[model samples]
Target chain A: MKQWMTLLNKELLEMTRNFKWIWVPIVFILIAVMEPITAYYMPQIIDSLGDLPDGAVIELPVPSAEEVLVASLSQYNTLGLLVIILSSMGIIAGERKSGVAGLILVKPVSYTAFVTAKWAGAMLLLWISYFIGYFVSWYYVGILFDTIPFIDFIQSFFIYGLWLSFVLTITVFFNSFLKSPGAVGFLSFAAVIVLIVISGTFSKWFEWSPAQLLSYASTFIMSGPISSDVWAAIILSVSGIIMLLGGSIAIFRRKELA
Target chain B: MSVVHVKNLKKNYQKHEVIKGIDFELMDKKCIALLGANGAGKTTTLQMLSGLMKPTNGEILFSGSREGDDFRHLIGYLPQHPVFYDWMTGREFLEYAGKLSGLSKKDSKKRTQELLELVGIEEAKNRRIGKYSGGMKQRLGIAQAIIHRPKLVILDEPVSALDPFGRREVLELMGRLKKETAILFSTHILNDAEEVCDEILFLHNGRLVESGTMEQLRDKHQQAKIDLEFKEDAARYADLFTALVKVQSHAIKRNKISFFVEDIELAKIGFLKVIAERNLPLVKFEISRTSLEEVFMKVVEK
Candidate 1:
């Protein structure tokens, strides 16, 4: 336990020194605030473009605050997910390639502790960045449109957080076996995209897949009290995170550090 | 007492074996040099011993226990090229290493401080490793390797990459380290092996070709040779020297010829007779024992 904490502290310090703490949250907040502000001023932005005929009657309906928040999530799903993947792609693969893993593994430290600390550190960064971004989106949505219920905001925040965790878990798992961080990022992104596509296309059949968490989060914002399907999705996603983490540790133990 | 014992250790990547089956024992409080040329499985052997690489087949017993034992706690290892988190200060890196070796917070800090001083890097303790010179990084590497005070510290070519000054500094440090704990260091440099090692293990083509104390190895491979340097026309004497029955083998470079002789006395008499008859312009002539470099080259070539 003590060794694990020591490694965890080291990982966190590495993150801080790399300025992940500063840049990641800043990027998240920028994306979150931009989504709602842009949605509210879409007509003005279009008018300023000046390509439309004079006195053109644009009859686009004002989107609800829930809709704006959901739009913000989609924005995060693309740009935010990209940021998370790019930042974390090197966590394990880079360490192994740089030979730092050999230095640490030679000590009395367990492979499980080393891997778990990395996962926890990545998860910590994900949680902090995602929550702060979500809150920023919430604040802007309330100002530009109707205020979302506090209970509804909290529920969606957790469900969305689960989706991010699932992605980060995949990043860590692939990083354990892959030598190149670029390949790890590519494969992880492909896997998540495939999951989202499959769950979307085969919704009835794959309703319990962790991929449903994204929709579950969106649904919680659009309405309230998600169905039993959401509970099943949450359980599946959490178990998936655990299984991936366990698999990472197993693979890392057997890996040969050159 | 032996701190580590290995029996028939082997490592294979796919069907290609890198480390053929070999065995050796490391005694407590002694320094052993693992001598091998590049690609001779020196690093592979060290990695397996350090628990960084799994041996394809073998038993590595630490203090007579092998089954279900965490022997890593009793061993510290420094790789050929030690990598560190560039963002970490020397002190922080040592603290991390100490903690990983199972030291408590206070104990780790104390040991980190002591090790910084011991490795002569106390002034650079707070500097980030990225900003450190190669020597400072190497000093820090040595400091981290011994922070836990393990029974045996394994250093893989510890000074192979350093400049002369850095090499001397680390060599001197290794001399002091052997007094506290057993050290098993690998190097291709024979002089390094001779300078500080109590026991030498010569590895060639993944096998333990020779191993003994300095005196034992010296006595075992001892051969008499005569070095002759001519002021001019040394090449003229080379053919004549090669034709002599007493000369077993000879190496010639520039104006000098080194003759490894079957009978030193006969070769000396024959050479003196040739010098008088041919009126060779000899600048220097001396008879001496063969060096470890010759022995190593002969062994590896075999």
Candidate 2:
């Protein structure tokens, strides 16, 4: 337990000292602030089509609370995806490439503790970033829509946490096996793309696929209760986390430092 | 008790056998130098002993309660080329290493400071390792290796990258470690093995060709050579020296001459008697011990 704490602290210190939090938070903030600002200006952007030579009449619908939530939530999802890729690339691959893993492995810490700490630390950073974005989106939604669902916002984040956990595991798995940050990112991005494709292409598993969670994050924010599909997505995503983590530990156990 | 025990260890990479059935025992509080040419399995042996790489066939046992799974924490290993996080400072690196080795956060921080001081890098502790010189990296490498104060320290060419001054300091620090810990270091440079090592393990072509105290190895394998300089021109009595029984080979360059003999004791005695009888003033003649380089060359040649 103490060893795990030391590793956790060391990991936390790394994130804090490296100014990683600065960029992480900024990225989320930009997305959060952009959501409502984009929503408030979106109609104006369409109205600017008045410059069309044909003078075509276009019907515009009033942006509802659901529309506002979806716009902000989708923007937040895109930003979260970027956060997962950027932050995770360094989590395990950086340690391995820098030769830091050898020193740590030689120590008294268990592999489980080391992997868990790394996974937890990365997830914690992303979680913080996600919530900051969540707060900003909520504040903007209140400004534009004149209403805020505080309890609903918190619950939506809880569900979003499950999806971020899935991203964290995939990052770790590739980080261990692949030593390059870019390669890990490329592989992870490809995996996410494939998951998205699979969910879209196969109607049967679409609801259960982990990819469904990212799209449904907006639904939760609009006072949509956590549905059976969300539960299935959580289960599937967590299962992927277990397999990836297990493979990482197994590969690390046999890796030759020299 | 031997802190490390390797019995008939073997490692093969594909069809090529890197370490062909080698064995060695490392007892507590003793430093052993593993000297060999490149590809002689010195690094491979060190890697296996540190448990970083598994051998194809062998039984490696650590002494006492510190054995098997728990044995890892008791061994400190410095690889030939240590890779460190470029972003982390030397102090942070050591703290990370210490924590991994099972030290508490408080203890790891304290030990990191102490190790930095020990390696004479306290001033540069805050500097990221990427900015360090070659020597500084090597020192930091050693610092991290010994942070836990393991029972056995395996340095795979630790000083190979350091400057002469840095090498000397690292050697001195290693020598100091001899009082408390056991070190098994591999080096292609025999001088390093000679300067600090208590014993030598010579490897040639993936086998343990020879191993002993420096003195024992010299006495066992060396063909004594005498640096002979006569009071008069030494070259004049070349035939006279060869005429004496016991001298197997003799070389004369200018006035100074050198002779090789199977038995240095016998040859020394005979040469002196000849000098006295000839009434030749002997300016200088001394039996020289075989240099570690000579020993290495001879072992590798065989």
Clash-forming residue pairs, model 1: none
* Candidate 2 structure quality by residue, lDDT tens digits, A1-258: 877887788778888878888888888878777867776787678787577558666666668765676676667556667678878887877777766676566666677788888888887888888788778777888887756578777776777767777876887888777878889998887887787788878947588887777666767766666567777788878887888888888886667654
lDDT of 2 by residue, B1-302 (tens): 58878889999999889899988899888889998888888888887887767888977888775335557878898888887877789898888788777777799999998888889999999998889988888999889888988999999998888888999999999999888899999999988888898899999888898899888997787777887786666677898878876777777876688888877787888888988887886778788856778778878788
> What is the C-alpha local distance difference test score of candidate 1?
0.89
Give stretches of model 1 more than 4 Å off.
B235-248, B261-279
DockQ, every prediction: 0.81, 0.44
Off by over 4 Å in 2: A43-60, A76-79, A146-148, A222-227, B65-68, B105-114, B227-244, B249-258, B263-287
For candidate 1, lDDT tens digit of each residue in A1-258? 898999889989999999999999999899888989998999899888888888788988998898899988888888988899999999989988899888988888899998999999999998999889889989989988989998888988999889889999999999989989999999999998999899989999998988777788888898966678998899999999999999999998888876
The superposed Cα distance between candidate 2 and the true structure at residue B65, in angstroms, equals 4.7
Residue A98 in candidate 1 has what lDDT? 91
Clashing residue pairs for model 2: A107-B100, A107-B101, A108-B100, A108-B101, A108-B102, B231-B283
Q: Per-residue alpha-carbon lDDT of model 1 for B1-302, expressed as tens digits?
A: 89989999999999998989999999988999999889999999999899888899988889956654878888888888888999999999999899888999999999998888888899988989999988888888888889888999999999988999989989999999989899999999999988999999989888999899989987778789999999975777898877765677788889988988878888888888888898889989899989889888877787
